[model samples]
Target: MQLHSSGVQYKLHLCLSVTLELILKILELKLMVVIMIKDWNVMDLVCTCVTTLLLVLICLLLYFISVYPENCGSYHGPHSINCLITIWEEVGCKIKGLRYPGVLTNADANTLKIMNLRNVKANMESVKSAADGGNADQQLNCYGIAIPNTCDSHNGPHSVECLTSIWESKGCLSEGTKAPVKLNTAEKEALALLNLE
Candidate 1:
């Protein structure tokens, strides 16, 4: 009876050891699953942050493009004003024998200094209109020119001449250049037809 009791106790110890090992393995598996889930959550958060940053950058780029002077079709900022002045200077140099009415003629220089002072005034007026929350029409009126209906109206040197003529007709003359009343009969008739007198 003593031997039989000893064998029974040995079997019980073996069974308890097996059950403990299985419990330890199950706990280790649960821990691994928790760690994987945490890693996945971190990766998801990083992806979301990157995506959000990219979206914000794209939106800012679009806003800048929309408000850019070239894109908006007029001088809306300091850069635009500078660009217009540069263009005016270039155009002034190119046109020969065409005197800017009211501007002082410097015959000493090879390039005629036909500075469009009106453009500076027009730029200031545009800035004021923008500050006043005026619409596009008001902005154009402030600039003393009509907005072109088509994009093509803003094309080439001819457009500049046309724009200058309009400003001249409105009595915005240069300071020292004499105004010549050399309009031909055809021109007078045309002006009459347009009621521009």
Candidate 2:
């Protein structure tokens, strides 16, 4: 009876040992998986950082390229001033034909008042002509303080006032404010000879 009891005790000990070993193995597996996930996260972060840096670099490069004087192409000349004038004149022409929402529109009234303040009637006329001629390039030059297409519509009195205020602030018809009517350069020689300080 003593021998039999001892043998049973030995078997119970063996079973406990086996269970402990199994638990250890499972724990090791879980640790390995956790380590692998951490590694993957690190790699993902590194890739994202690289991509962001590359995008920033690309944007900076594009900005520099756009502003470089050498990239101005055939428009490089002292007559650039004259060219600008011509472009604005063309755009003024186009704006003339645009249909306003109402003859007694607040936008029209505001535009008239602003124009009177700036004495911008001539410039506006030129811009209208350019727009009417379907000269897209000229129209682009007429931007910055000029009446946008939205102004032709009667949005409201607030919009009209806002637009007029912006135009006025740009020195449109103010005395002693000379409107730019000429291109800075007329030809390659003029550009090369220009003393841009």
Candidate 3:
């Protein structure tokens, strides 16, 4: 009632502020889950990490919009804003891994092609089988994939959990190697040209 009495613009500002706080809290919770969950299996880790990433991206977008509402067109209603957030979340998921639920997100039909490692794809089936067979050695190897000590090793799936079932079957990660934190010079230049520079 008090908020309504403050008039439309004031009410909208209040609402947006409240919404930002809520979104931040939610993102914090997701981050907490990402770190707190111990004894995670491949499936659990993949889903949780992807979900956390999407939430983090959403939070960033919300913060930006709250700070720069003028950047959005006047015609955008609450529904449009919701749709935009949903789309961004999906994009974040795709970047992090397969696009959730199911389907080959990267669109490369061959798992080997998606991974981009020679001989790994052909050997994927065998590796997956080994991973699935409770090969502790393979599971331990997956740890290397998780942090990836070197950039040279970072060329495959977005996450170890993103690999196909066959690939994940081996050593928790199968063939999923971490992607690099920093992009190559060409990729950086491309983004810069787009003004994401």
Candidate 4:
């Protein structure tokens, strides 16, 4: 979850940085043109400068809005769900030759979801099995938790509480736990799109 949030922020920063660089380049070009054309009328020069600045401002505003979309009612799904759709497209995750055309239909979403679920589930089950293994300290490392001096304060191996906390922290729905796994927006959407959610 933390990784996903960081990834989104990094993308936004990269986009904004690129945008600013482009604006700066355009401004530099305009400055050069103004310097070369010394015969330009004052009013005309002012108008040109104003127009250039306005266009840059507008472009920046539009880009900002797109990066941080407002909460539109989630008929298709939540804003985060829509975000996943974008990330996948950027990395060339394609689902060509649609069965029923017109974007991701129910059938497509279901198929994608099922395929994703199979992969995620298999990985999760492996993790769970490992978590339930002999060494408690090792399981701590498995979930990215710091190894404590004692497992469950010396409650020892097969400690259900320790096991639950480790798996639950990583958002895995282990066999016995009733609580649903807490997923990030993109993960949730990806799972939903694949029909794994």
Residue 10 C-alpha lDDT in model 1:
54
TM-score preference between candidates 2 and 3, better one: 2
Best by lDDT: 4
lDDT of 1 by residue, 8-56 (tens): 4555555556555655655565457558775666555555655655565
Q: Rate the local accuracy (lDDT) of all candidates.
A: 0.38, 0.39, 0.36, 0.42
Tens-digit lDDT track of model 2 for 1-197 = 01212344555556556555655655565557558775666555555655655565555444333321221122223223223333333333322233211222565434443332123335555554564354544444333223345333212222433343434566564232232222232432343342211
Worst 10 residues of 1 by lDDT: 93-102
**Selected candidate, larger TM-score, 1 vs 4:** 4
Off by over 4 Å in 1: 1-35, 38-40, 52-82, 85-197
Q: Candidate 1 or 3, higher TM-score?
A: 1
lDDT of 4: 0.42
Write one digit per residue (lDDT tens) for candidate 4, span 113-196. Answer: 343323423433443344445444434423333323223332233233444454566677765334224454554344333210
TM-scores, each model vs. reference: 0.20, 0.22, 0.19, 0.24
What lDDT score is found at residue 145 in candidate 1?
35
Off by over 4 Å in 3: 1-6, 38-197
Worst 10 residues of 4 by lDDT: 93-102
Quote model 2's TM-score. 0.22
* Clashes per candidate (backbone, < 3 Å): 7, 36, 3, 5
Higher lDDT: candidate 1 or 4? Answer: 4
Q: What CA root-mean-square deviation does each model show from the true structure?
A: 27.3, 28.6, 22.1, 18.1
